[model samples]
Target: MISHFVNRKRELERLEREWKNVPSFVVVYGRRRIGKTRLLVEFSKNKNTFFHTFFEGTKESHIKALRKELAEFFSDEIFLSLNDYYTIFRYLADKIDAKTLIVLDEFTYALKGDKELASKLQRAWDHHLSKKPVMLVVSGSLIGMMRDEVLSYSSPLYGRRTAGFMLRPLGLFDSLELFENFEYGIRTYMLLGGIPSYLIVASKYRSIKELLKWEFLTPEGFFYDEPYILLSQELRELKLYFSILSAIAVGKTRISEIGNHIGVEARKLYPYLENLIRLGFVKREVPVIGKKNKGVYKLNDPMLLTWFSMIYPHKTEIETGVIDIENLRDELKKVMALRFEEVAKEFLVEINKRERLPFKFERIGRWWRKGEEIDLIALNEKERKALFVEVKWKDLNEREAKRILRDLELKAELVGLNGWEKFYGLVAKKVDDKKELSEEGFSVWDLADFKRFISLRGEV
Candidate 1:
């Protein structure tokens, strides 16, 4: 089991600083299982805090639940008579004479039954909460809904927030802490992404193969039905969203391609695509130096991409126990191979931040031209310098690495960085003669190098 929290030092520091200024209204939100609740709990450890988790139910039921929690906390039956969110919040503001922390977790669920609660909250904060020495934190999982209903310009609570944070998944180095080895950690990351809840669960398994078997192949596993659960919470057009995601998963990136696969017109798919983009599941990508209208849509969540690509289509066979690890072996490799490109991009960004690259690149992303693509590209336009890279998940020997580098040089010319001093790099699962290649003026890296980089940073 993992023994400690990974890298949330920056977030913790910000929370502490915010809490020092009493009457602080903080809004915290992110995707599900991203550790927002855990962060708040950790931040509240030494403070007089009242934490309430909102449930999905009617207003009366939620009010009843809140009343019970308040009665127990203050040891007063008077709270039992308090009805509605406005009264309870007013009571909280009035009763907290000293500095105190109040957390309303899953604020989306709380507002589900009472749409007017936000406006009520606005009035409460204006009349009482703003005057009290209380640090109030509200967190939610439905990012789209939270932004629209609470953080938007027309939102009642828009101007009331003193500070807010849209939490993101942990980075690669922090995610590596959940596994016994870097190889397994990287594989698990490709499948589950950097969501801490999934990482912690995967950490218990002896190997990534076992984790995939139990969590993905089994119908009752936590991740088996997670996409459906998460998507249905924020989206109403489930069938269309699934179709679009499945199309993108299977290599249909362009709007025309996806629309054709889904049997829909491209124009008609705009709303659905926009919603997916807004929800952070699908991203539209254009070549770093290409026309915006000629972009493509791709899955942004590795976990969701894996599910729709592999498990969703074969759910029946998996659920009936007809499909086993052997059946999934090749498909797993394919998924990992695609995901490794993204991992390689991340690696480039990290090394760039550390100034480990030959040049400090101002921009980096995948670059492509008609019928040609570069796996990774880092460019410093003002300096007229560029780095073209090819990422491979297979083991490569000296000759094979050299061949890839030669091909990468050919691709680099098509990247439209004419007159720029160009460089070539290669990343693979394992390289036979990395030192020899580096001596030859190519930036060659392997899995072992990544592990060394991550490990050294962990120590420091």
Candidate 2:
């Protein structure tokens, strides 16, 4: 079991603030295994709390389970016999004498089992629970259902919530705490993208190859079927979505290219792509300094990216136990390279947060026009200053580093920020003469900078 609670200070502070106010309704939600339950549990300590986890079952069974939990918490036999939501709320309102917390975790299962469950809870809250000194929290992992049934405008409980937020995965800095050092941390982050449970499993392994073999390559591996489960939870048309993800994973990024790869017309893919985007699976990216219509899709979820890129395409060979880890090393390196660019961007953003960079950039993203591409561009539109950065996944000596930076200066001209205060930089795994590059007014960083920044930030 993963016993350590890594970092959710902001979330805990938010919950604690709400705890001070009486009659607060809070909604917490996210993708499964993203630590929603654990956060709630951590927040619920040493209070008059009643926490119940609803499973997939009929409405009657759900009520029975809730009643049993409530009866145990309150040490009152009355709750055990109350079989309906409204009546139960009424009884709690009548019997309670002090402030209390009622947490409904996996509450979507109840909503799934009973279509009228939200309305019933709404009615209960309006008539009885809302006036009491109680804080009601409902959380679930079904993102679509949670939004529609709780957070959406059409939902009965929409305007009633005092606060609501979708808990996202940890950032690279925070996630580094789970690993031994920067190499293991960055490599694991490239594959898992800061999910706590997955990182816990990953922290147990010594090398990337061993981790992949034990947890991903075989049919019985923990993550072998994970993407399928996640997709099936929030989406229909699984086969089509899988195809789209796989297509994007292998570098078919344009809408037309993905359609061609999946044997579907480009126009017909918008809805599926939109749904994926809405659910946080895929993201559409356009050049930071280009036309709005020039968007290309990429898998936003890192686990899915790893799955489709490294596992899904080679499933047949993997299942037959004939696949060699060495054979996939090159492809894995490519995936890691792409992911490293994202990490580099994240590092720059963190640096910008503390004004460690030359100027505060308002926005940053990849920039490309035709065949030429810059790995990253940070823009301060108001100041008209721009930073062009090239990210590499390889080690470069002083001569090679200067060559890449000179080429970056050339590409900077094509960006059309001629009058803007343009700056050039590089980020890579290793750079031989960072001090020299820095002295030349270039922003250069390698893994050493990553470790230094992380160490200064806090424990890791």
- For each candidate in turn, the TM-score is 0.97, 0.98
Give the alpha carbon lDDT tens digit for every residue of 71-147 in model 1: 99888898999987899888877777788898999999988888999999999989998898888899999998799
lDDT of 1: 0.88
TM-score, candidate 1, is: 0.97
Cα lDDT of model 2 by residue, 322-401, tens digit: 99678688779988998999999999999998788899999999998988999999999999999999999999999999
Which candidate comes out best when scored by lDDT?
Answer: 2
RMSD of 2: 1.5
Clash counts for the predictions, in order = 0, 0
Instruction: Determine which window of 10 residues in candidate 2 has minimal summed lDDT.
Output: 451-460
For each candidate, the alpha-carbon lDDT, in order, equals 0.88, 0.90
Clashes of 2: 0
- Where does candidate 1 stray beyond 4 Å? 458-460
